[model samples]
Target: MTYQDKVILITGASSGIGKELALLLAAEKARIILSARNEAHLLEVQAQCLSLTPHCHVLPMDITDERQVQEGAASAIAIYGRIDVLINNAGVTQRSKLIDTSPAAIRKLMEVNFFGPMMLTTALLPQFKAQQQGQIVVISSMAGLFGYPWRSGYNAAKHALQGYFETLQTEQPIPGLSTTIICPGRIHTDITYSAITGDGSAYGAMDPGQAHGIPVDVCARKIVKAMRNKKKLVLIARMEKVLLWMKRYFPPLFYFIARKGN
Candidate 1:
């Protein structure tokens, strides 16, 4: 559970939960490697990390690019000699009704939300296996737990990660290797604004659910604790926590309730 001296790499570190996590972990004395597509935003995050702690570095790269993901992983290993934690937090969302969803829109979501993380994890798996000790943390959504209206592609991608990572855990049971899949209900972030719209533009709006879900700082702390404790699955949010349990025990009722969720 000790974070001191551990090397942690986080994608989507440019802003929101990822940036908050970087700052928190840096303050805990963990060596941090921040990666995202925006060099400018990455630098800003790196600066903030430096202000909090000196053990922080930036490796800006587009997660959607396999080569960049590989290079970024190499850079992290080169910096700290090894990676103790890899947080797959980079993802994009889209809000569109199923009937209106286009092939292109779904592909875009898959590229960033599903394929990007899959590629990044695949690139890191070798090192983790060789060491027999590493943590892979995935930032999924409650949408992954159940289908949500107006986010067909988004839900599918997250659901895919949950399936793949969970199976990866059973298929490759490396001693000391750990995977934690996080399903967050909502939070006040720019995620909605950045979410792809039906017309292929940013949504540029906020959802009330996200506005009142949880604070980013609180969520970051919970995530760090879960990672350090090596939790296999962690669901965060007041109402979503209940839904998580329901989905496991009362499938029929869970489906009915989920159908009623907005």
Candidate 2:
């Protein structure tokens, strides 16, 4: 679908994929609503978006807060009339072994990565159903598709998202309502450094896989294309894309290799 003048709300808009996506969509002439916890950073991203597009709104929101998420959804509708798209891009990653991760840390990840998006989506669903036309894009990860090492909690959260969105897609029979789940192998984002650690501290360092992953702009562009096409699941990055198909059709081999990594 065309994005011109379409209202799109993106969480985690301060930096990384969300920031890049805001810029990309703004250039497409979409009305962008930016949301994140850091008001300062939201302003920073707003400035960047305004430089690119004339229409942009900044809504400082902490997705972890259900009240704030509901309010933010209302605010976006008030500002733009209707939300054409809701991008569940706000999420946190954990980089720790299962045993190393504390119960509190696991809860924190689940709150931000799973429950936060779920709440936001539920709050917005009424609006979408009323409009009878809306798109929900989930910025999931390859970790969601397969179990990975040292990321049990993170994997669990993303996996949950995949299940939820996939089910939503199946349940939604209306041609106008849609969902897209993006499984990116790795993108050049600071997610690793910002990832929560076992001790509940930031990892504070980039991982090699993330550093060498596809560029954020490239990944965002691909996602936009997939969203417009109304794809249920889109996997970017050649290696990871291949791996996803391998895991689906060649489960035994995938499990064998995956076990070696573990």
CA-RMSD of model 2: 1.7
Best by TM-score: 2
lDDT of 1 by residue, 1-262 (tens): 5787888999999998999999999988889999998889999999888987778888988888888888887888899889999999998888778788788888888889999999999888889988899899999988788776788889999999999999987886678888999988887778888888766678788877778869999999999999988888888778877877888898887888877765
Local distance difference test scores for all models:
0.87, 0.88
**Candidate 1 TM-score to native:** 0.93
lDDT of 1 at 117: 93
- Candidate 2 local lDDT, residue 261: 49
lDDT of 2 by residue, 169-211 (tens): 9899556889999988878998888799898899898887788
List candidate 2 stretches off by more than 4 Å.
173-175, 249-256, 259-262
Among all candidates shown, the one with the greatest lDDT? 2
Candidate 1 residue spans exceeding 4 A from truth:
244-262
